[model samples]
Target: MTTIPMYDPLSPEMISDPYPAYARMLEERPIHWHPVMRAWVVVRHADCVRVLREHATFARDPGRTGEEIPDFRQNVQMMDPPEQTPLRQLLVGAMRSQDKDQLFQEAVAFLRGRLTAQEPGEPFDWMATLAAPFALHMSAALLGVPEPDDEAYAEISHGIALRMDAGLAPENIPQGDAARKRLNELGESWFPRPEGDDGLIANLIRRADKEFAGSHYIRNSAAMMFNASYGTIFAMVGNAAHLLATVPGLLPELSVPSHVATGVDELIRYDGPAQGTSRTAVTETEIQGTRIAAGDSVVTLLAAANRDPLVFKDPQDIKLDRRPNPHLGFGSGPHACFGSEFGKLSITAMIHALRDEGLRPCLAAEPTRRTTATVRSLDVLPVRLSR
Candidate 1:
């Protein structure tokens, strides 16, 4: 085995196409100390799963071990087991147990509405034309945000993502901060007096005191939830579209609901929103013979973990219905995405809507990827819808 050269995620080459680097790392050193990132990089599927599953050993907040991972900055992502448990349970439990299929149909309807708005034979950037709007609206609906304010919230989410996805650029810090403040304010104002159908906001208000400190904490948690799925879902929609357009026969196979459901997992497994995540080692630990000191920052390489050949057969190739797929694209354990199922439903809906509309979208030009260390999203996708 050859030694893989140390590479930074912020580098230009990695930013444009990171799989090669990720592949190299998987072969040479699955787990090692990242000098640039100042974290222990875990790339293998099993190791990453261990890191995510053993919550107490590798704490998200690391407060128990004297590591000060702030909650205001990361919200639930920054919390540990006992603290994170109730909050996670509340959100997950709020789902309508019996109306899941009904929810799915509603989601499909919402996506079709957006996909049909595009004119055939005309070129449009998929990112802006459909992906962003659809994801943002769904996110707003999940948060129980009202109509007029949802649009404004989307803009705020965009600013926050610009600041977050790109490592919080120097010029973007203020905008991100202001967006946070406004979102917190919006959450506080809207949650106490939710109108129409009850959703995330109402649920948060109902359970805030039990899971969180107070209304102020609820406001902050809402801010993190607001920024979490909104933009990432936008990126995933475009990603799946790109794959469907580029990969032959995928468009047809993925059109089927069962296939679409499975294909959504493959799409996310192939190029999911989260490339990697940072966690602090709560205690002295050893992963595959490598010793990790307490307080070390562990960067779980989710992107690399998904492609580990040891776990999945033909990991590189995109097979629509790859079953037994345990990709860490959505993180794992306590820190897994709160709305993971909803994301899959939304993307599947996007595919069905596009296929149903006879909208065969093709990439007109080379799409641009988001230039960020953390965010792996297409900046723009120039697509032409056709017969």
Candidate 2:
């Protein structure tokens, strides 16, 4: 009998910096079942990619198998191919012809105005004031939420993010429940008749009315959209800013507006906000000669896979001009992130505005990191800016 290597997913060290554990897995036990988490961790670049792409072998839809994660019901990310097809098409088409250039310009203008209005010396939570708000507004505008003011959107968005980070803990369950209730209420109130339908929520409602007239479907779908747009976008902005501060000379390269757009990919690859994603195997399978049984959960470490030496030479270094950069930052396969372009555009806009405003960095403070079973992001980033 072959001795299977052991790994603990809930270990403190693994949570803080999972790369070491990932490396160990890649080297010795790339497909071992983790007894603690009751999941098989797929760590190598090749295996991760294969698992993501091959939906037949590794299932995304937990519902199909009567599997349920209390927090992730009705999420598009949890849906399999055929069921996900129509919804994915709707979202893709909504943002496909979007004028990214114009959007980026507007984002830059907005950021410039906000940063310029702030006093140079006084400390402000950059994540709260700048990155988080900017991401929320962008998502709100794109999703067609009633963006009355920056603060209003930020408050709702932040509340939702905090609720998600808390992850169904006894103390946090109320917040998540409250957020869902509030979002549903907002959706019902605003999308009553769809007179001024512009955002994604309105579009989804319209589609549902025209095609599938069901209250539960529309409400759950809208809630899922909110989770994706608000949470992921916030992470992208915060993570990019944090990376720019830590990586030497990366900011200067990003100063060029074109490079800002191009470099967003590199930033995501280097330190993507999404640390890992979970899937469950439906049948017995052998991945890289390691057998995994049916009904076992699998956590694919995308961040670690992105840094695999076999796939990317000098994997840790940031190369802004890396061509053919097929990083798993946006994930892969049927459930690949639909909002990837929107996220890239938002980050590009912020970087370009910072450069165009001739902003100089005054001080770099350590970023507060938010860790979870899935997403990774900065809780706060402190930066003094000079114009």
Candidate 3:
């Protein structure tokens, strides 16, 4: 194992492609202290798995640090079991009960509409016109909520995504809070939700009493879900599309349904948006010979772990048909992403729709990435579609 420099997420090199840095960490410092994150950076696949799964040892609650909880840490995403379980069950059940076929059809139709408007051979910003609106439409359909105005939705999405950075950049706290407030306000309008099969909201409202005590919890949880759905799917779709456009032969290969069904997971494993997530050690624990003390923060570099050579064969290359692909594009354990199914549906829908429509999109220019560290998303992706 060869050691390199300390890991830094915000470095310019990391912003463009973090995998090389991740590869270095996996081989050299699988678990070590990170000054920027103020946590022990865990890069090995096995170690990241352990950190996420052993919730009793590594808790989600930031309060374990014995510091005042930050504003960004107040939501359902930051809670542990007993407190986290019921809300998790309700949201997960609602997502599961969703008519996946209906969602898929709707997604395909929405994407087709956007693709039809694209001028062939003329470059267009895919992130703005297609990915953002499509994400909003699908998430709105899932929640059974009226889609907010585009301007408002964009502002909120940007803010909430920035909030995740508060751990590293405290200046983001204010903007993150404002975005969360707006999302909550949006969630508030959905209720007093009528009980019916309308969407996830109705399902949540009907089961709210059993799941949690207050409307506040339900509202915040629902808001969190909507934000996650729109923002996460937007990032995932954009990232996947970039791969299709840039990676040789991937577009044609994944255009097939059978291949894409498995390939979507590969895309996520290659470049997932939720790059890193953290947990606080509740008690002293040892990982790969490194002792982590109670109250210390352990940041799992999920994107890095996904490409660990020990776990993934030819870890750097994308194998669309790769099986037994136990990648943690989504975090594992008690807090695994609740919207994982929806994400897969959206990506597959985009690919299948493009193939059926005879539209092949290729990158017209280099794509630009968002400035944030925690969430790896595209800011601009220029492409030209050809029939």
Candidate 4:
């Protein structure tokens, strides 16, 4: 067996840019046990697909691996079917009730207002002013809840993101704990809500059956949906904006209405918000000739899988119209992202608004990235918009 290189997710370099390290791992150890993470790392596209799709062999809940997980982590994404199926259906049904065109128009108006507020020649922080607020607005619309204060939302979301890394970085536990507490409090306020309400939370509360009657189940699930919706769009738009500002030849392609949807998929495949997610082996499984015993932890490097050259030709380059794109940006199988359509609509709205306004963004200053491992986010993105 070839020796696996040390993989430290918290390393500053990895936090800033992990694709290089992921490439090396994919080239050498497609699937191997990592002593530090105490899990098998699966990097190749085919292998990662196998791990995500085969729910019978690989379970979403870490508890199956004999590791005790906090209750907050037990949202629908962490469950396996038959338990996962009905909850997913409920969430999906609630989401379908959202007005896609109306939401898109709302997003466009919101972005236009933000863009117009900034002077043409002056640089403004895109992430703080535009990306985050746009995401928050869309999230509130989807949940049928009033928009929360941006500062408070930022603090809570940051803590939750940090909490995700608590397993790998022990120092984040306290912040994660605080975030969890705040989230629980927030979830509580939404309850005793009328089932006749139009928001996604109300829909879930109304449709919840005896199995999901537990207070924690609905609350945590709603919170999960809100957070995931906010964070994904925030990161995605920021990443896309950065590319549109810096990458050559992208602006023209994406400006076309027909290409906007295709471009969104390309952006997700290129540098999606989620870096990776873990699954536990319920039964002994072999991936690419490597044997994984039951109860072993397996981490699928999703960002790496999306860029695997064997599946995506010219994987490093951005092809806005790339076809047969089977990217795992939203994952796959039983646990695929529940808000993918909504996410796509929100992202497409931003791009289309920019196109209509003839707004071309250029980087004003060097952008900084967040240090979190699980959610790849931008700390600050400064841009100067020109019409």
Top candidate (TM-score)? 3
List, residue by residue over 1-387, the lDDT tens digit for candidate 4. 656458888788897788888878878877777776788988898988888888989998766667786776667767788877887888888888777878888888898888888889799999999998998999989888878888898888888888877658778888887887777678777776675687777777677785675557677778788888988899888988999999977888888778888889999999998888888898887888788899888999899999898899988889998998999999988988979988888888888788878888899999999988888889899999987
Better of 1 and 3 by lDDT: 3
Candidate 3 C-alpha lDDT tens digits along 303-354 = 9999999999999999999997999998899999878888899999999889
With a 3 Å backbone cut-off (N, CA, C), the pairs that clash in candidate 4 are: none
**Stretches > 4 Å off in candidate 3:** 1-3, 67-73, 194-197, 210-214
- By TM-score, the candidates rank as 3, 4, 1, 2
In Å, residue 155's CA in model 3 sits off its true spot by 1.6
* Reference-based lDDT, residue 262, model 4: 86
CA displacement after TM-score superposition, residue 8 of candidate 1 (Å): 1.7
TM-score of 3: 0.95
Deviating ranges (above 4 Å) for candidate 1: 65-71, 96-103, 147-155, 162-178, 195-197, 207-213
lDDT, model 3, position 284: 95
Task: Flag the better candidate by TM-score, 1 or 2.
Answer: 1
Ranking by lDDT: 3, 4, 1, 2
- Which ten residues in a row are the worst by lDDT in model 2? 161-170
lDDT of each: 0.75, 0.69, 0.86, 0.84
What local lDDT does model 4 show for residue 122? 96
